[model samples]
Target: MEPKININNSTHFSWLSCWPQWTGYAAALWSLLYGLLGLYWFLGGNGFPFGKNDSRAEMMGSFLSNLNVDVGGPVIAIAGLVGTVVAIAMKMTWGSRFHRAIFLSYAWIMSVTLIFIVPDSRIVQNFAYLFLLHFDLLDWRVINQVFCIVGGFIWGASAIAYFRLTQNACGNCGRNDATEGSSAKATAKWGKWFTYFAVIMALPYGIVRWAWALGIPLGTNDSSMVGNEDNVRVEAILGGLCIGGGVLTLGLIQRWGVIFPWWCFFLAGKQIPIWFVMVPAMLMSTIITITGLKLSPQIIFMMVNGSITNENWGQFVPFLFWLPWGISLGIAILAYYLKRRGRCKHCGKL
Candidate 1:
């Protein structure tokens, strides 16, 4: 049964709902700006263009050399593209639980890939050795892995629940038997495609991790690096699997939004708290998309010209400026839409 959303209920537009949107917007803006600034610093020669001869590149190269793999530029670009597409899709399809579910699942897959592929040891060691000399949080690996895993699960489950609620036919909306609609059919097809894509994407990392976990020597990497890599891969694989399974189940039953999977525990079969789901999802999406859009060009230019050095860092300031402005404007637009949607056409509550 599809749950009847009180779209016209003014009370539903309470500050609580608005706050998450605002918070997400703000965080996204700041993160995007900072990331751009960071990239500018990297490329303009003032900081370190990742592939150039700067301190940052040297550090990264050394780290990668130790890991026996080249740092992947295309993979990073692909992740950015996926993140941007999903974010924009979410914004355009705001009230549709089905679209939101698909977007959320995509975002989770990207996040998991980032965690696994980025090499946490490199990030942690770089920050500690190059940026923060006095920090000593090495033993917090377990805690960090736990947080990432939990976050991935939350995102995957949220996607499932939202999709389930939207497809439900027995609810107050009386929109059941709606599967014959083209939109419904298209969405179902997309769900299947996404499930297969996520599983395929996750397989490489999953195989390596599983082998490593069972005391099999898959490679000669350091124990810490191996463990971190395995954890990240497993998190991504599990998250993808959960989302794929949940969506498939929902599609089979024609249930769109009502949560039925007891696996979600506290949040199972419940209307997701917008704050917990929408807020973080929006923020993360905006940050990654905006940052990528702003920085990729500059990074490419620097890479081509081989001029990423300290002298060019000033050029990055523009990226910082554009990112915050863009993200803030995006948030404002979303807020306006939410406000407009608050006015119920059926009941005129707002």
Candidate 2:
């Protein structure tokens, strides 16, 4: 006879009951470590992430690049200490509405600043470079930015868990029995529109890029943009990514998002894991938003100075929509999550 196994008695199942508390602890630990790193930088330990030490620093282009170590370092250290305190407080189940509001706002502000503001285009560019097997862009700057992004994610998760707990909702599913039917349904309703909008935003860039790759000047008179084989390869790769990502965005609202599509061969008809789709979509959305914001200052300056002429306007124009594309995609992802995250096993909420 086969051995009987009691999965409920397994150690892996133990953490679920107290996951919110654990997440808060993790956020606190991250804040403390980051604070210490800031203190080290303030004390003139080498490798501060901003200003003169950052090789990619361009005045007026990056916010961090303008922050001198003497000022930014101590500020960072102080902020981290405060963040640690906030994380610890959030872990507990105490506080009035006003106090909770302040802490939650701080948590979200830190999350947004770390994930979206601290990172520049280099992080996204590194992904492209990595595709070409180039290792030069994989430097300490990228690593530091990635570290900040991880901290952002930890804090965001902790804040969300805290929110659910405070509201007396199911922590696993974020649904209050008293207010269950309205929010999720409404979000899912609006999600379809956001998905369509996201798809539309990507089309122009993808089409123009593909046109350029094929030696056709869709917006410019010059075909020299793709005259060389290397340039053509780069254009093609970027075009493919834009188009492919747009297609994948549609999956968020489609049947295939929940069940494997026929294209999956043996995996077809299988129920898709939510994280498999959610993780990539959320990460890509964040990257797109960061890239758009990072490039805005320089790009806008170029436009103002008439540096971007008719011959090159096409390449730069479509990217200006990246910020909106990212935001819409993010909303769509949230909607999809609300729609699909049904029947939480831990909380037994439907």
Candidate 3:
């Protein structure tokens, strides 16, 4: 009951149908990278990760501090080697439950762990500034995380796709079954919910930000920060844009989101590229949200408990939207991939 895919990257390859077949290889590659890094860490060196693996910011360093480097290095290397093997084994047509779990574990751990490596200056700038303004700086701190996210997304999404495709017997594409249509409908339904939740999560954050720009002190402990007068116009502009953009994000599940309106002129009615929507949504929202959470403990304490503290209540404003924004967008991205599973532009298949 596998649906037929009508797309090809070359005479020998039909990527649309063959994409999932490569997830295992991708997972193995990531595992190998981790293994090598582990080996490097074992060498009493600091660059286990590209930049800023210092004691303060390094992930899980505090807990692992007591473990001698001599021992830790070997342990890490062993795990990497085992992971590489396990990851490689799953490259088969159907991955086991254990392998699926492994994929999810590494995907989450590896990708999220990279967020901790972001610098202090980047942390203080706030999420919006980092995402909107400082985005152009081509630093490896950002690059590493991007790789982490991409690797995780690929392994995880591909595994799910493989399961769904095989489960539906979609591998037997010759037989016409209700699987494709039913699965698409289900995926789309989830997509709608994801988009709806994403809108709700983002709407409040944008509204509060907009309010801040208008000098309507939302939570800043310092009134003068609002009185800067310079921010009044600047923040207002940013707020308006955030409001508009948040609304536009809902278009991910809407008709206009998929096909541009007539006003778009030449691009109107054409299917928008998935990466156009997904790349920004995933990277920007993720980094912003993590920046909100992954920074220093003092800041985190204030954000979470600021609402209760008599002083500096405004510190809590960022928290109100940060988590929801991250979760909402993450789920929304999943829904997007689910709905558009087989519709690859390069392969020209749907």
Please report the candidate that would top lDDT against the real structure. Answer: 2
Candidate 2 per-residue lDDT, tens place, 1-350, comes to: 21111112335555744566577888889889988888999998888988888867673245688788899888889889999999988876447777888989988998988998888888777876766677886888889889999989888888888777777776666766676655667787799999999888777778888888898887676657755567788778877888889999999999998999998999999999888999899999888888878787778888999988888888777778777888899999999988887766655556
lDDT of 3 by residue, 70-189 (tens): 665676577667656655654443365666566556644543444433223233234445444545544544454456556656555545544444444332121124443444567677
Give the Cα-based TM-score of candidate 2 against the true structure: 0.90
- Residue 75: error of model 1 in Å? 27
TM-scores of the models, in the given order? 0.31, 0.90, 0.68
Stretches of candidate 2 exceeding 4 Å from the true structure: 1-19, 59-61, 94-96, 218-224
Query: Cα deviation of 313 in candidate 2 (Å)?
Result: 0.8
Sort all candidates by lDDT, best to worst: 2, 3, 1
Q: What TM-score does structure 1 among the candidates reach? A: 0.31
TM-score of 3: 0.68
List lDDT for all candidates, in order: 0.38, 0.80, 0.56
